[model samples]
Target: MAFDFDLFVIGGGSGGVRAARTAAATGAKVAVAEESRMGGTCVIRGCVPKKLMVFASEFGAEAALARDYGWSAEPGEFDWKRFQTHLKGELDRLEEVYRSLLKQSDVTIHDSRARVTGPQEVALADGTTVTAKTILVATGGRPVRPDIACSDLGIVSDDIFGLKTLPKSILIIGGGYIACEFACILNGLGVEVTQYYRGAQILRGFDDEARGLVAEAMRERGINLHLGTNIVEMARAEDRWEGPVPTASDAAMSQALKGAASPLARREGGAHRPGEAGPIWVKGTNGQQDVYDQVLFATGRTPNTEGMGLQDVGVKVNRRGAIEVDAYSQTAVPSIYAIGDVTDRIQLTPVAIREGMAFTETVFKNNPTAPDHELVASAVFTQPELGTVGMTEEQAREQEPVEIYCTSFRPMRSAFAGRPDRVLMKLIVSQASQKVLGCQIVAPGAGEMIQLAGIAVKMGATKEDFDRTVAVHPTISEELVTMKTPMRTA
Candidate 1:
């Protein structure tokens, strides 16, 4: 069948762009449509900006630590406006790089939304329809606020990047990495940060010990973290005061009302509007009521498969709105395929790029390829940070007999400064085969450490193999190789 192009990608995200560029390199005509800026979540909003914020937030502590190390250093105030201005410029430059890369590969770019209109056809928001020999969906996902009263008054992870000013106080909802990370970031940035999690522990589904240490570190850093707690009701502080005065049971509410009326909550002109940098009164499930300068909902994220005409064209979508694809990322319709967050398969940016490359290989190079999903290492940028790969100790014990080698202690740097900070290194190993089943580290730069550990684990390195490697002394990671005995065997 004659088509407008060999490939038409619906998203200009990391996955879609990589696929488009790689496919184009194979001498195929490729076109990509992106409604928003290029580079998708990782470059535009998620990783790049958040990491920069993480770096910006850490300087205050770094200056303090420097003073303890006998250096004449004084901590200073953070300038949100100054930092934000630079952040915007960096994102703009990255978006241009993405556009240039696609153009360099001779791929056409459409700055509009697109959706599947038929098996081999796509319709853009501009009322233009194009047919392709293959259709690739990489629309990615978006941060979602919970369905609740006055939830719109709260911001999501995406909105954090665009905040005009840092709030004096913020109530971050949810226990996932996003909530915890922002709680730390804001707290570090000199904001009063309170976190609520309905779950018993934050970072659920991660190693129990690792998450416990992270939660403990969060509390130590002055994040008023509340577990097994959620918001019962919330409204703008002004609206709350329109009713009768609070009773004695509402002492917390009264205190919060006073805070709302404080100069810190009010601006030069007037109090900010609801959903802006305004005071929000929140009633928690635990009977605590308070007003915060900002409320952030990091509840979850959903796939971007809605109104895309996917199902009508025989592309199956799951109940959670994720596109269903086989191991090779091909959908039910052979002519159509999906990858990245839209497929809900390993929602990491690198994983998405890998999937895109695999798709190009299978479709263009005539070499069938499936992106590997096993032992994918990831880091949660909480205060202490968590880097993990492979099975959790809980999961390993349930599947097979395992031995656990674990250790937790204050690192040399933090201990020298007389800080209470402690780091963790744990390994879950198969008892019978002596293979390292999992690796988890909770420390500064654990993200970087895990990438190297992930390589060993991915290569099926056993505990003995690690023992054979000489330990690099005076390092937190040396523990990974030096642990001679199992802390526990199951």
Candidate 2:
């Protein structure tokens, strides 16, 4: 059957872009429709801008240490507006780069919302229909707010990048990487940051020891970390103090400002006035009431599969709205496929790119591929980052007997400067196979250190293999090699 294009990609995210380009490079006709920006979430909203903020925030501590090192360096107030301007410019440049790549790949770009109309037909929001031999869905995910009163008074992680100004004090909700990272970032930027996590500990899936140390360090850094606590109620801080904004809920506010340049929660319902700065009042699980300049909710993310006509066109999605895809990223309908966050397989950007490449290999090159997800190294960019790969000690113990090797001490530089900060290095080894099952590092450069250690773990390197290597003297990572005895076996 004749079609408008060989492939129609529904998202311009990392996965969709990669798939579109690769398929186009195979001499297949390709067209991509992106409702928002070209570079999708990571390039535009998530990782890139967040990392830049992380870098911007860390300078405060760096300046503090400079004084101890005999260098006269004084930390000054952060000019958030200036940094925000530069950040927006950088994202704009990157979006242009993405556009250039798609053009170079000979793929058509559509700046409109698109949905699967039929087995091989795509309907654009502008009332245009395009047919394709195959359709790819990679719309990714969005931040979600929990159900609570006056939640609209809060913002999500995506809104952080779009904030016109940083608040002087913020109440951060949740304990995931997003919450923890931003808690550190905002605190470093001289904001009074209070973090509330209903869970017993933060970074739930990470190694307990590593995350515990992180929690400890965050507290030491004046984060006002609160555990086993959640917001029970919320209200606006008007002179008379009424309930939530009558017009918009926090969820509505998040949705309305999903992709805006500057996202401010404006109340647009009943008695609430739009464009007014409504300070939020909250009551916590522990019976505490306080008003914060900003309330940031990093509770979780949900797949972007709603109102895209997926179900109408016969694509299956789970209750949580994540697309159901096979190992090859193929949907129930052979003419349709999904990847990346929409599929809920792995939410990492790198994983999405890998899935896209694998999809192209299978569909275009006739060489089937499944993206490898084993022993994936990941880092949480909290102050003194946490980096890990392979299994956690708890995970290893659940599977088999494990030997744990761990150390914690003040690093040379921080110690020399009389700072109380300490670094942690830990390795989890399989007792039977003598293989190093996993490694976690908590330090300033743990993210970089874990990348190299991940290679060894991915290769199934054993404890003996690490012992055989010579130490890079006086380096924090040398501990990965020099630790000879297991601290405990379980």
Candidate 3:
């Protein structure tokens, strides 16, 4: 059968865009379809903007710490609307860059939603169809909102970016990274914040010490930590009382200046309205309908497998609707493949991008592609933040004979700032081979630290190597290089 292109990607996210460009650069015809912005979640809503806001919000906390830093400046107010305007402008500029990449590579960029009509053909939202030798579903995952979260208010990571202003007092639900980051962003921005996690702590999958420090730092910041709490039900100011779950409710989520939470709950849902995003009432595990200005379900994500025509082509999806892809990112149907959050395998943006590029190289250029999923670094932008890679002390003990070395101490700067935040560091080393099994950190710039160690852990660094590395005086980072004793031996 004659094909219009060598590769046709169904989503224009990190994975799809990379795959498209890489394949085209290798002289294969490529086309990509996207219903939303060019940069996908990272640039558009998730990482880029989120990190920017994190920096912006940090200014407030730093303002307080400035006095300790021997620099004094009066506290200033934050303009969420203006900040958002700037963020959107920057994002639009980045989108243009992505567009330029596709043009430069001569890859067709179709700004429309796409679905698999069969193994070879993909139908765009505009009813245009394209045929290809291989179809890639880099379709990213969608935010999973709780069954009942808010009525006319509340927000998700996707919706938070478009908010007109920040909430004065925010009640963030779930202990996931998103919830923790939002909590940090808001609290750092001078919002009286509270975080509710059904689990005992935030960043559930992280090491025990990192989780402990993050949780402790969060509590120290007056962001009322509500752990192990269940949702009861939700209520609206106008609506009458009801049973466990209420049908009519309003949810308002605000970030700054303009406050909009589920229908006027905290500090009145004034200026900071949802813009186009509204809130709904949510029933909590407490058996009481809790009404908050902003409610976030950072619980998890579901794949955007619907309306993709994948089912018709026999592309197998898990019960959760995630595309069932193997380590090589191949779907059940050989002609079709999937990557990124769509497959739900270690849902990191970098992972998805790598998988996409690898798939392109292996199939088109005859280059072997298989990524070592181990020793990949990840950071949760919580107050102090948590970064981790490779195995946890718990995970490594089961298989590899290992020794666990860890330390928890107030970061030097925090000691000066009078903030009671502790930086926790740990390394898991295999006793048999003397190779580093894992590395973790709970501190500011943890993302940077973890990535540096990721290379070492991946290359089989030993405890002796870490010990031999010279410590850079008294810095948060020195904790990783200077740990002298083992916390536990297997």
Best by TM-score: 1
Candidate 2: segments with Cα more than 4 A from true spot: 239-276
lDDT of 2 by residue, 1-490 (tens): 7999999999999999999999999999999999999999999989999999999999999999999999999998899889989998999999999999999999999999998889899999999999999899999999998998667768888888777667777889999999999999999999888889999999999999999999999999999999999988665644223334322234343333232232234344344322134556566798666666788889999999889988987889899999998889999999999999999987899899999999899988999998898898989999899999999999999999999999999999899999889899999999899999999999998989999999999999999999999999898999989898989998
Q: Pick out the ten consecutive residues of candidate 1 with the lowest summed lDDT.
A: 261-270
Give the Cα-based TM-score of candidate 3 against the true structure.
Answer: 0.90
Per-residue CA lDDT of model 3 for 286-359, tens digit only, reads 43444344565566778899877788889988899988877778888888988888888878999988898789
Q: What lDDT score goes with residue 23 in model 1?
A: 100
Q: What is the Å distance of residue 350 in model 3 from its true position?
A: 0.9
- In model 2, the Cα lDDT at residue 179 comes to 98
Write down the worst ten-residue block by lDDT for model 2.
254-263
What is the alpha-carbon lDDT of model 2 when measured against the actual structure? 0.88
Candidate 1 on 1-490: residue-level lDDT in tens?
Answer: 7999999999998999999999999999999999998999999989999999998889999999999999999887899999999999999999999999999999999999998999999999999999999999999999998888778778899989888778888899999888889998899999888899999999999999999999999999899999999998887665666545343224465575644532223213344443483667788898777878789999989999999999999999999999999999999999999999999988899999999999999999999999999999999998898999999999999999999999999999999999999999999999999999999999999999999999999999999999999999899999999999999998
- Per-model tally of clashing residue pairs: 0, 3, 42
TM-score-better candidate, 2 vs 3: 2
Please report how far candidate 3 places residue 180 from its true position, in Å: 0.9
lDDT for every model?
A: 0.91, 0.88, 0.77
| Model 2 steric clash pairs | 151-250, 152-250, 247-269
lDDT of 3 at 128: 90
User: What TM-score against the true fold does each predicted structure earn?
Assistant: 0.95, 0.93, 0.90
